[model samples]
Target chain A: MYSYSDFDEAFVRSRVAQFTDQVARRLDGSLSEDEFRPLRLMNGLYLQLHAYMLRVAIPYGTLSPRQMRQLAFIADTWDKGYGHFTTRQNIQFNWPKLPDAPAILGALADVEMHAIQTSGNTVRNVTADHFAGATADEIDDPRPYAELLRQWSTDHPEFQFLPRKFKIAITGSPVTAP
Target chain B: MTKAHDIGLRMVRNAGGEPGFEVIVGGGLGRTPMIGTTVRDFLPVADLLPYVEAVLSVYNTLGRRDNKYKARIKITVHETGKAEISRMIEDRFAELRPLFGGGDQAVLADIRTAFAPPAFRDAPVAAHDAFYRADPVFRSWADTNLAAHRNAQYAIVTISLKAHGQTPGDATSDQMRIIADLAERYGHSDLRISHEQNVILPHVHKSDLPVLHAALVKAGLGTANVGLLSDIIACPGMDYCALATARSIPVAQELATHFEALKLEHDIGPLKIKISGCINACGHHHVGHIGILGLDRAGVENYQITLGGDGTETAVIGEKTGPGFAYDEIVPAIERILRAYLALRTDPGETFLQAYRRVGLGPFKTALYGEIGQKDAA
Candidate 1:
């Protein structure tokens, strides 16, 4: 599991504070849903049919036990005691309040995780073969390349308006483009 | 996604399951998606990055980005035509190919180790029957979902996400942690996501089935319906998908519910039902034995069915079966088709795809919607 550097830590905390402010305004009705939709989505918050669904990005589906425990905590506190891991390697809580998402994001930031770019037609969590690190049939660890892509695609201006949500699944060098 | 073998190159399969050092390129997903025509079969390791650049340059220039629906590697290959793309790739390949031309030896020079499958003990077949022994629940699930691995002592495992009436591919945070631990303990700490949106422990020792099953059961990943009718592939639809005209997740749930109610999933023997929010086909509707693509009719969600599609080593895009059905009528429509497959299939050995190929879609369509025509041609 990769630990967050100092820079990664600050970046996440900043993003959390930013989202926390946004959530406060939205809950206070100072900000409209129309304006907040993308913001919330970027933060992996969704107003689903039954309740709010908060999707937490796992960043290429990699997680340490500590991070996993934090997720369990979120599921217990803000959700229905469970979370859904989506096809994109992200987790979704079927229940959460509109006002609680920022706190969830804040918790995720503490774990060096965030929901940024998990949604909204941007280069999604740079998916890779789940067998990247330990697969008997891979080149180098695909995570580094996936990480490279994460940096490259983060708030990537050029790909902002891709025709569709572009999902790039890199693999062990060139051997398996899983 | 590039596959080295498809490009006319060849290499020895490693003692482990992987092929010798090389690269494959040009695969993508979506409506016009392709499995990517393999550009180079087996090239040396060093040529990887440069060759990838060549392929991307071609795709970047030629791939259709205009039509949101058609902008995928498959569409590009289809429109540009494989022959031309091969030539362009070959031409570009010559200059860039050498970078990776150095082969497996180069990998030794680097810190990364070569990839290979482990040696298996090739144990005498355990009365696999012992696995099923008598627990009908586990029996049915293991029969439907478990896949045999090449290693006599190992099996490829699919952890199904379908829970009947629930979102198909959704995994809870707890589920993730449990599965991760399972991978670390039972599997090789390696997991792969199947195109069907299921998680796969690609290498599970056969002896560990019971222990693995118990852990998975606790985690809710032990549904044991890997290739069965209940194991469906569906895209997030109108609920969250902005590109969707109709909802797919709900429709998938309804069908799964219906199938569960009937208790026909495992007994149905290897049937795949893929549903997509729209023709963008994220759920891989094109590959389902009974494919359902959601349609919006008068602001209401309807579904169009397709037959004979498969996603595998032998892949075929599905064909439409006449008109679409309203939301209420869709599940029953699926039931009608499944019945047709059941009544028509030769035996349990004949899967839905095989049966479809043998008898074709006409009989099934006629059984559901009345005969406009009848022919066995797939």
Candidate 2:
């Protein structure tokens, strides 16, 4: 599993600070639903049928035991006692409160995980085979390339405002690709 | 090979202990989902990264951005044709190849030198049998849900999500935590997501099956069903998709309710009913044994059913059973089709698909819409 560097850590910390202020503004009527919608969406918060859903990225679906334990904690503490594993190799909390979401995002950042690019019309999470390194027929695990895409796509200036959400799934071979 | 004193790569096996790398691009599900075009039939290990770069650049320059529905790589290949796409990719690939591929054969040799399957202690042959004797649910799940491993001592386990009438492809976050823990403890920390929207632990030793089953059940990720009728793939229809003409999830829920009510899934053998909101085939209705596509009839949501579709090594698009059925009448329509398959089947051994393919979709059409005016035809 990849650990976050100091720069990555600082980036997430600032994001949390920004979102916290944003949430407070929304509550006090400074930010309307229209104003708060894109801000929250950029952070991977979705307003689903039942409640607000938070999609936390599990990059390439790889998690350390400690990170796994933190996910269990989130499920137990904030939302329902479970998380849905998406086809994109990410996880979603179906019933997150609007206010607790920043705290939830904070908890994930503590473990080097975040909800960045999990939603929005921008490039979404870059997915790879869950069994990348351990697979029988891979020429090489595609995660390194997937990671490269994740870095390149994040807040990309030109491709950021495309007409639709962009998704990229990288697999080393055709037979096991999808 | 960066030889580690006790470190090693686990589980890489094919004939002659090697399989060449291949690549596909632009495969996705949505309104226009299609199997990705084969971009690389064989990529030598030395050129892996650069080839992928070339593929992405081609897509970045040429992929559509005007229509949200047509923005996927599949649509790019569809519009330009695979040959043209490949030609452009080749030109880009040539420019990038020399930069990455030159004198990298040693790295290639180093990579292959380290990969191998895990070695496990032989457990008693009767272990699974002993567990089966104690738990019937475990027995049924293991029988249908597990895939045969090339290494006889291990099995690929599937944690089914298709509990009768629940949302498919969904696992609560706690389920994710537990599954990750289970993978580390029992499955060598490797997880897999099956095409059918379920998770897999790829390398479970036979001895650990009993404990793993218990933990899975506790977390509510355990269901004995694998390929039975209840394990459906449904597209998110009018609920979220702007393109859908009808609802797929509710229809899937109803079918699941009907089959589970009858408790006839096992007796009927394996059946897959994939539901799509439109002809784009996101739910993969075209490749299902019994496929349902939600459409519109006079501005009202309706369903178009197809039979004998398959998505295995022998993939085929299904033929339609009839014109279409009203939203309220679709569930009963499917029931009629299943009953017809049961009656027309020559043996219990024949699956619904086998019978449908053998007798053709005409019989199913008659059973489903024999009462409709103008005589519904397959």
Candidate 3:
């Protein structure tokens, strides 16, 4: 797994700080639910059918063991004792509280992961075939390219207001008959 | 990759043997399912960023904004027509290509270094062979959950989250930690989550698989049902998603439990059962060999079945069978179809899709709808 560069670390920390403020404002009744909706969603928070769901991005479906342990920690401490991994290679904590959102983001930052661009009509998680770098059939590791795209698209200013969520997938290997 | 993604890139070596992409644009699944069109037959690796930028730019400028349902790039491609879309993308790519200035390549080069293949150890696999010969349970899990690795000494183990009757993709905190531990100890600290909603230990030494399997079994992560009937793809339907009209998780659980009770999942062979709560297709039901769409028809949970949908390199949309089944009736309906397939297939080797493609939907339709075709003829 690629370790986060200093710039990457700083960027996530800055976003977490910003979101902490946003969440506090929303909880204190200053920002209306309507007002706070997009703010929450921009950070991958969703007010679901029963409770709040926080989706954390696992860029290109790659996770270091340290990161996985952190996710497990978040699942155990904050939300329910489980997490649902989505089709896009992201994980969703189905029962997060609005007040605890920033704290959860902080824990994720400790492991160099975040929920940025995971929701709200932005360029979403850039996914690739799970077998990248490990499969013999691969012509090249697509993770590097997927990582490049993930960096380019994360919090991309222009893409935040797109008509719908945009998705991009890359596969380094040819598909065989399933 | 499934052709249902918004942009699907298949890596291919051109005739001259240089690596590049066969870029397919505008494929999506929701209310509408489309297999993406191949806009560029062969896009050089150097052009990937710029070309993708061009496609996005074209979409941003021209894609429908009036209707939420039609706002996807798939609809944009459909409305614009492929040739015009291709031409527009090409024109945009030509204009945007130079702006990149190869900076992306430098970053990619650096990223590539991080992903270098792990050091595989040459260890004796005598124990692995012995276990394979001795333990039937270990052998079944090994055959079902493991994939051949680039290094012969290594095997890619798919840790099945689809333990019988469990929510398809939910991993308990304890299971997550167990998987993390396995990855760190035996899997070179590499873990992958498949789109099919399973965790993968991508590089486990074959010699270490038995121990890993025992740990996984202890954690209740060992069902040995990867790519089997019980290995379903189900979305968080009405249970979680506000947009859902019906529940998907319970249906998946019931189906898995039903098939497991029959003790027939392994014999049923590689059957994909994808269930979506609504038309959003989050579960990728359209691609399942046995696709089930749960709909709230007049306040009742009605399930619709689609047969022969495939999500491979040769992707095809599934065909819907006759009338929908009630929530309670769906499982039995499915059993009938599978039983019909078992009886109709020429051999056990013939998969559900192969049998469907060869014999067509008539037999399965009759099985599900109870010989309605003959009744209508009569």
Tell me, by TM-score, which candidate is best. Answer: 3
lDDT by residue (tens digit), candidate 2, B283-322:
7787788899998767999898878877543456677776
Q: Which stretches of model 3 miss by more than 4 angstroms?
A: A176-178, B373-378
lDDT (Cα atoms) of all candidates against the true structure: 0.67, 0.71, 0.89
Give the per-residue lDDT of model 1 (tens digit) for A27-139: 89999999999888877677766677777777766665557678878888887776656656677777788878888888888878888877675566766555554445445
Candidate 3 on A8-99: residue-level lDDT in tens? 99999999999999989988899999999989888999988999999999998999888888999999899989999988888999999888
**What does the lDDT read for residue B153 in candidate 3?**
82
What is candidate 1's CAPRI-style docking category based on DockQ?
A: incorrect
lDDT of each residue in B1-378, candidate 3, tens digit only: 547777888888999999999999888888999999999989999899899889888988898889989999999999999999999999999999999999999988998898888988999888899999999999999989988888888888899989998999999999999999999999999999888888988999989999999999999998899999989999999999999989999999999999999999999898999999999999888989999999999999999899999888988999988778898999999999999999998999999899999998888878876665636523
Q: Is candidate 2 or candidate 3 better by lDDT?
A: 3
Candidate 2 Cα lDDT to native: 0.71
lDDT tens digits by residue: candidate 2, A21-124: 99989989999999999999989998865578788887766666567678878988997786666545677787789889888988998888899878776777
Worst 10 residues of 3 chain A by lDDT: A169-178
